[model samples]
Target: MNAIADEAIYSFGIDIGGTFTDVILHRGSDGQSISTKVLTTHLDPREGAIIGVRQLLEQWPIPPRQVGRVVHATTLFTNALIERKGVPTALVTTAGFADSLEIGTERKFDLYDINIEKPAPLVPRELRFEVEERLNARGEVVTALSQETLAAVVARLVEQRIESVAVVFLHSYLNPVHERLAAEYIRKHAPGVHVTTSYDVAPEIREYERTSTTTACAFVKPLAEGYLRGLQNNLRELNIGAPMFLMLSNGGLTHLEEVLKNPIQMLESGPAAGALSSAFFGKLDGYPDLLGFDMGGTTAKLCLVEQGAPMLAYAFEAGRTKRFMEGSGLPIKISTVELIEIGAGGGSIARANSLGLLNVGPDSAGSEPGPVCYGRGGDQPTVTDANLQLGYLNPDFFAGGSMQIDAPLAGHAIGRLADQLGLSLVKAASGIHILVSEAMASAARVHIAEHGRDPRHYSLLLTGGGGPVHGYCVGRKLGVKRLICPPSPGVASAWGLLVAPVKIDRVRTLQTTVQDGDLQAVEQSFLELEQEARGVVQESAVQHQKTFVKRLAEGRYKGQGFSLIVPVPDAALGNEQGRQALIEAFENEYRRKFSRAPSNLKIELVAIRLSVHTEDLIEEGLQFPSRSGALAAVKQVRKAWFEETGGYVDTTVYNRDLLGSGDTFNGPALVEDAGSTLVVGPNATCSVTAHGSIIIELH
Candidate 1:
């Protein structure tokens, strides 16, 4: 294939997930988009991504030179930490703080459990070395860094063949001079070793969180560098001369260099992109406030989107021993889209527990073996197998007929679990399906309630490979009346990467009372943060594109250990009016959360944050293309099981591509698309929107 017209340009978005690699292409000449999905290559994720990209471009026949931009998001770093596949790393901390990771805030996620297991530290004790350096809370040096001790630590690290090191000095967020000096010495002596400092990764007051965040960055630094550079080189070799932008956990995009420095920032990159995609499609479909339900092969994630933006969180846990427990995972302080994730997906393993109760999963078969229906050597019963057994999935139409699925194999796999549970095949399959739906609904309820939102008020927008398949039952459980399945729901995350803005978030610790404090210093600190954030954004921003900045402050009452984030006033904070505005904002937010504010308590500002991002590049109200033919919508009829219908009933199956705008259909129908399938329950009214989205309305 030859290159398109020189004037026309194209952009590619690639998302490497746990089970699949999604690649999407968008043309600048027209609002055309296409996507493809391939099984993830667990050995080297880059290989799967490259293959998907090559296949997409070949199918669409777009030349490489015309590709102007490449945006990517991946779960590689997160998986590395979870699987302990990262290189050997070391930690250098101030004296007497070597056990900080072991003694993490002295808080237990489950207090009543006699034997609670905590996430282990990435670096073992032998790999953790301490140096003689100290700084007080006021940023004053208490004990100077011992040069001989630091040199010896560096020598020990080199001797141990540590490829990466995390240097976290006490109070380094306030005074990083000692940490910087140690890093400089290490780089000079062992130039091959990578160094990460707490101040650079997470400059906050919490000792344990800062150290954990830095250690995570260091642990994945070498692996991230190699994979990213190799992917870039391979793209160039394909004659695609575009600059690649990486997706950040905070629902933004950054340059390769920025993420290589702190790979932890990409920990939630894939899920964040999925959330952003939901928000983007929801707004276009006239539902700005909705809940994003993304159920891929490995897990299900739910995020709250309000006013066309998904909520942002400052910190999130990674590699949790307990999926829903907060402190059961490593605490990493990085900005990310707020969401709750549960282990309920198509590939989630299903089995009878010791108590003779059926349990779905926190474990998935992934794409390597996949579900039994894929004929990938999988012997375990999974949600996909159960769905197939229930007639919810068309074996021949799986993955748009790109791959053949064996229905008998799926039934045989589920038959074992059915026998153990002493239930019929159909009954057992229904149990598995309902169990996963209930789990997702339970998690979503808590997540929404935590944000003081009512599930009935928010429309549920479903995406990912499994979302549409299970969305109806999940939404019904949550008492949600409406659900939306956007076009190409399976590869939405890749499309999200293309629309994400170039963003940078910066923070600084500034302890001060709203009533009496150094206002000038606070203002100066914000200015500095904004300047730094904007500089980073410019590295990835388009030439001459306008940028926007949002100022936020983390504040708390006088004696509180936790803080809440509130928007800071746009006016100058050096004046009394600005201070009053800040206080009012904090109080307003407090009232919303707690229903009232204390009358006689002082407000303390813990930190200030600045976020800079380029303006949205995609136009609003853009609609996806519809089918060009007048072909009949109903492709076939299949006997499908539905609780509402009691037993197997002949259900009309419709091809999603043939359903044009305003096409209306009733329940007990299956809308089949190339990427995913949407199941409409009995009595529910399904309609096609102008943009090719399937909207199911249930009373």
Candidate 2:
């Protein structure tokens, strides 16, 4: 491979998704970027990323040695937990609490159904061992840990050949003495096994969530370690001497070492990157409030971004038995960018149900046997096949002509479904397309409503491989007046990693009534959290820069079960003015969420959160190459389906790369690029911005 100048410096961002691996190589000096996508190797995800990286380096003729930093995000850890492919693990909890995971707050996701199933615990009762340990809610030891019992438990674990163990004790979040002692003994006796402690993973009050999160970390620890180490060694073999960083589920980048300790923090890493991409690109194009819509092969994710920041939630569920049901999954207590995911994507299988109604998926044909249109041995018809039948995708120009697709194969598969539904080909295909879009739109509506936001007020920012292909219909369903499709929408998540800031989030649970709380102690606690968070962020930073810290607290009425998060002032809370400010902040947030605050209830503080980060690395803004030349001609005219046209109509097709800034086109058109395609419906006006993004305004 050819090499660029020795002085040139570059950064690499790789995102491995369910169906594709996206790689972007960015030149730091001038903000130039080149990206590519390749089918993910399910057997080994790293192999696909390495292949994509090699292709970009060779195609751009840039030396691997000049690459300054490498940032990556993947769904491997989450997939391992969902598929139950991780190492055999065991949970160790306080005596008499071995069935806590099974009991699970005794709540049912479906209350009315007589036959309801909850997700099984990761650790079976046979493997779960308990020890004599007790700590009160005030962090006072009620009963000291019994060394004899713990020793016996350790021996059983080693004898059973367990690969990993989780040490969890009641009230460990308040005082981790027993948990730490147990972990130390286990590590000393079983040197070959991995250990995860609830205190270290999640220092929160919820026992079920903490135990679940800890066991999850233990289950995926060995796999993540091996994968990360193998990837580092592979990069070195390719002569890319760069520091590696990982994107977290909270839309921040951290060093690999931090991630190895708590791999559960990366549960939503890939989708978080897509949300950040929407915020970044949306803000650049003069829109701050937006609804991020990312549709890939297996799933579609929707997140809300307001004022250039995505919403964040402190807890998330994984591997849900019911895709839309909230409590049908494992609870993980990690801070994550709030997102609503629906099983509506390009690869979602479509079929006729027993009741003679058409049904799309909550299941998908992943990259292994992708969509039928790819000719990859898939016989079931998918949304991609329906789109291909509807003329939304160009067979000859798909994936920039890098991968050839068979339209006839897609037609045959979709035709079978049409025959089952007793509908014409065009109507059947359109029904599938519209069905998936409606699913996404319906989910987005509920998500937005929950956040107290209106769909019409927010512009829809579309990304991912399938996002642009179906964005027009999805946007119209939500009543959005505008849609923003950024450059290289297919690989936008990878690009998001490059532009993300080094960030860390830290939290501690401190239960106290606000009216009688120790204000000085709370202030001291915030300082300590800030110090810890800053240390981590500093370790991830390459150079010294201005650091920013945000303080937030979760509070609720004294007798309530849950709390609401509110921003805390930067001033000292010991004084009357500061105390009053804190009270008002909670009241205002409470009113905003519930329409009113309780008149006679005292507010109790539950947790304090700190967010630390360095300024964005790209302050000068991303600059796209100025396409100042004359507007190029349309590539071809093809028959494309549109409801307004009543059938397939001869539509204008333009090469995206050939369209310059200020080029305007009225739709019943297709704009084809290497990574994805933008289908513009009739009466919609499309314009190319100076940043090379397509802005579509609908009537």
Candidate 3:
């Protein structure tokens, strides 16, 4: 394949993580890129973006107008939901059906626990108003919507003074006639208030998921829209004329208009960006299957990527009161990259429990006061503090030495917790390290197991500030043989946004028996939906120059509650032979997933989902230095603890900037750069790749 480059297009990517705000500026002409990381301003996330952009400008003198594209991904919306900071929302649904959000399937994910907890509904009972409306399973109106019912609902909404309203009627996915009427009336009467409908957010089969998705969109609409608009205005004020875009949870980049209509799509976009980076960079070296790991300040995420594509899931829980408990969180229906997240990171607090056992965390010190070593008024010991106490982190060179770590303060905090556990300082620090690593490994096991995957078959792709620090130990525990560390690991998420495609996802419910249904009509349905999706692409200014359309449908046994995606060929529905091929394809996929297909059950097609993507974004000819195994790269030798050795070892510290392609080094060693530090275990060997990445082969 030939390389493609937009010689005139210069792009900038911005990603705001809990601990850092990363910015990257790239010139398409030469494939040269420079990135910078600044401390995140949590009080106002926008301020962090501004500060990072300015810092990068100081280092690379590029005019703002010359930058053609600006893409951003952040954790702001997800944090808002977790912190219970959303706009006042009201739910308007079919009469007597307002409880679906609260009565989700009534199946406890944890059957034996008596004190199971679920997230409270976004809209309370007093704010949920019902109207007379009904639709059959066939999209036919059973009880026609009345003008009086709309009038009464609108009156109640105005009286409540709610900031946003979610309208979801019974069988709305099959037919949205009543929902449309209610929304139209609300917009006219309750002007200036945000309105979202179930069919617009999630047009699916399940009522509980559809209603919850609609409510979540409403809950965050006001907050996300206001923040985005204000940020755009600020960019304009700074004379940056580039078209700005936002990242979506599905690992695509879309304009602000689409995200404003459905804010729930951006909830997990931050982690999705990091996963995309591994998929994109891993392919450059011919690795197809990867265990993408990103450990930041407050959380660690692991995703499975096969052949440069991340696995996508349609449903997941958010804001779980219990960590890793499925049913305890709010169910959201949106296309998102499948990743498992745990509260194990650099900022995870370390303390002795009442039983005198040391626990790493489900809590974090965050970036406000930060870890004890940050010397930002944090009194509690965190993973970072423990790492510092163990000499894995350099007190004189933390954050490129811009912020000096308080080594003494960090010791005092860890020492205090060590006394409670009746252990020495070194043992206490090592216990914290092992405990957090085990937690990450356990989460990865569960995530890989759910997909019937073996962790031994995948190589760990590490990114984020804390990723390289913990990757070696975690991969060893999982019995993985290899780990790859990329350049600027902490800013990899921002880098992912630079190479992401502009995509839009669309869905239509078509519950029918494939054998009995008219195949031509099914083929015709995809074309119609493709047209609608094209309308959205047309509105985007950055993409649609060259586009691609993929078609897939969800299929299941007649009585099943779940479904699997089956690819439908372009010519599959036009003829009898092609139609049989379609059935065979579905059956093969079903058997592969479940190991068997029921002989007595018939097959049913549930829905058709379409994805429209812009032309694949390509970046090639990124120049790197030739191979060199020179001794000048080594900066110093410091005494660092190696748990495998049972004590401290003299570790060689290397300056990453001085390392070249094909360079090889033996551990234990520290590879330090401005953005992050890579720790090589004594049992592993590190080699620099042609792409300027370090590959560690663990024995």
Candidate 4:
């Protein structure tokens, strides 16, 4: 097939991770591209963003004025919460429940830990005040709100000079009237303070989860709002008039205004973008079932994609006391892609435990000190240092040689670890790599099993900085037959931002079994949610853009503790046959998830959900010009550690920018690119695809 560059419409995507800021420029003509990664400016991530953007434009010879809309994603909000650096906020809860945030259902993640610590409550107990109000599950007021008590609570909040407040009442999800009125009074009395209500934030049944979600929204609202506003102003200053949209953890884009009111929805935004990109690429390549593997500088994220869609979870725990524990941190009841993440990225620090066992990280050196190989004052060994010592990376050519790696230092770092472990340096380095791969594969297995799926059935699509470098070994460990690394694996998250759909998610709580037969109420709730979604998508629309809305429901069998999400078509919800059809779909989904549905029980619909989306398709005719002939191996052959071989073996190194489609290479080889490197281990072979990607098949 001839190269197709004509469809390249120039667009940009920016993703700011914990350790780096990645920028990508996609040229419409021939799919010519530019990608860059800059050290994150933790003081102000925007500084690194600007630098990355400029570097990409300069490298591609593209002027900033001609650029189209820039899709941006970031982990800033997530990091702020995890690091406990968010704004100080207060809480105003229903009477006798001022300690809701602190109590947290009294569930300990570690059942028997003598000294296990829970994440500290975001709002101090002193700042949390009790207000008199009560609502039953049926949305009936059991006790009238005491105005004097509310006023007194407001007086206390004012005295404390609280900057933000969260209003969570008993059973407010069933009836939001009390919450609405309290919010209004707070705004009127405590002028200049931010307020969020559980009904508006997360209209779910669980009081603890709903209250925590609302509190987090209030806690981060000021910081996220101010940061986004600053970013918007910076973009406007650069003459980038295109509508600014922030990527959501749900794999959609939301307006800046919406996010300012609900910043909790932005957690996992950066990693979610990478998962979306991998799913999008999988669809384009006709792979329906695949694994989206994204490894950046600080963490590796793995998500399962089935039928071209990523799995969604309604609740997620952040800043957990235990890594994989169910109830350790703040709970957010929001729609988000289900993914497993671990501290196994390139910069994961290598250390000796107190017991003298070698351990890789849950902590990282980050971009500042980086790895010992980076020669940036990092004396500690890291995953990058391991890769460098094993000869998987080219020291002088790392990051296109813009930054050189200190091989001698890497050797020294591994050497120390080896001495401690009673092993040779190469064995220690390779062991670290193998251990990391096993950790990733193990996590992926657990995540897949949780969803009632087998991990062995899916293909692994590896992306991000360390993913491709270590993908082969990881894939082998997981029994994956094929691994695909795209043209720019390191910047996959940036690519995902550009390809995401403009959308909004709206939901309404309607907790009732079919015996209540409130079908009309159900339909009405969906209609209201649809209207809210339409308003959001309409604002996101551009000229001539068509809009589409879809309906869904959170449902379960009566008496079931949990629910399964099922899509509801408008046609079905609009008519009797359609309603029955949706019921069948729900039953099938329940069976798929739980082996079987209880035929004796009625179906309970928990929430009416809807999403209005406007799809922006990338032009189809874009193609990059072909580089003629097979890529020549530029560097002399070297002995690199191959874990499978149990020793150092001869390996070949080639420049990726010069590689032509259809060229083939074997394992124990390195394909070096400007932005990242692809390592092919022993017993594997890679072929350059028509799209300039390296497809590796394991034996």
- In angstroms, the error of model 4 at 296 is 1.1
lDDT of each: 0.89, 0.89, 0.85, 0.81
Task: Write one digit per residue (lDDT tens) for candidate 4, span 1-699.
Answer: 111122325777889987778988887655566788888888999988888776776677755556656678989888888888877688888888888777888877888998989888888888888888898889899988889989999998888888889999999888889889999999999998899998888987888888888888888888888888888777677665555677888888766777787888888789889988888777766776899999988999999999987877778988887788878777888878889888888999887789978888889988888888888899889998898888888887777677777799889999999999888888789888988888898888888878778767888998888988888888888898888887778888998887787778877888766544667778788778878887776665544466788788888888778788888755645467666777788888888776887777888888877878776546253354565544464455777878777788888877777778888878878777766777788788888777667778888
**Collision pairs in model 3:** none
Candidate 1 vs 4: which has more TM-score = 1
Instruction: Write model 3 residue lDDT over 1-699, tens digit each, in one string.
Output: 111234445777899988888888877767778888777889889998987777777777777777776789999999888887999999998888978888888988788889877788989988988888889888888888878877898888888788999999888898787888888889999998899999999999888888988898899999999999888887777678666788999988888888888889999999999999888778877787999999999999999999888889878888988777777888898889999999998999998888989999879988888999888899999999998877778888776776778999999999999899999999999899889999999999999999999999999999998998889889999999999998778788988898787778888888777766677777888888889877776565343267889888898889988898988876657578767877787899999998988777767889889888775464463445553453778989998888799999999999887888888889999988777788888999998888888999998
For candidate 4, the lDDT comes to: 0.81
Residue range 1-699, candidate 1, lDDT tens digits: 111123337889999988888998888777788788889999989999999889888888877988878899999999899888888989999999999999999998999988999999999999999999889999999999999999999889888889999999998888889989989999999889999999999999999999999999999999999999999998998999788889999999988888888889999999999999999889888999999999999989999999999999999888998887889999999999999988788899999999888999979999989999899999999999988887778888887787889989889989999999998988889999999999999999999988888999999999998999899999999999899999899898987897788899998998999889887899999889988888888778777778999999999999999999999988789999998999899999999988999989999989999899986555442347766432487889888888787789988898888888888888888888878889888969988888878889996
Q: Provide the TM-score for each candidate, comma-separated.
A: 0.97, 0.97, 0.97, 0.94
* Candidate 3, residue 241: how far the Cα is off, in Å: 1.6
Q: How far is candidate 4 from the true structure (C-alpha RMSD, Å)?
A: 3.5
Better of 2 and 3 by TM-score: 2
RMSD of 1: 2.4
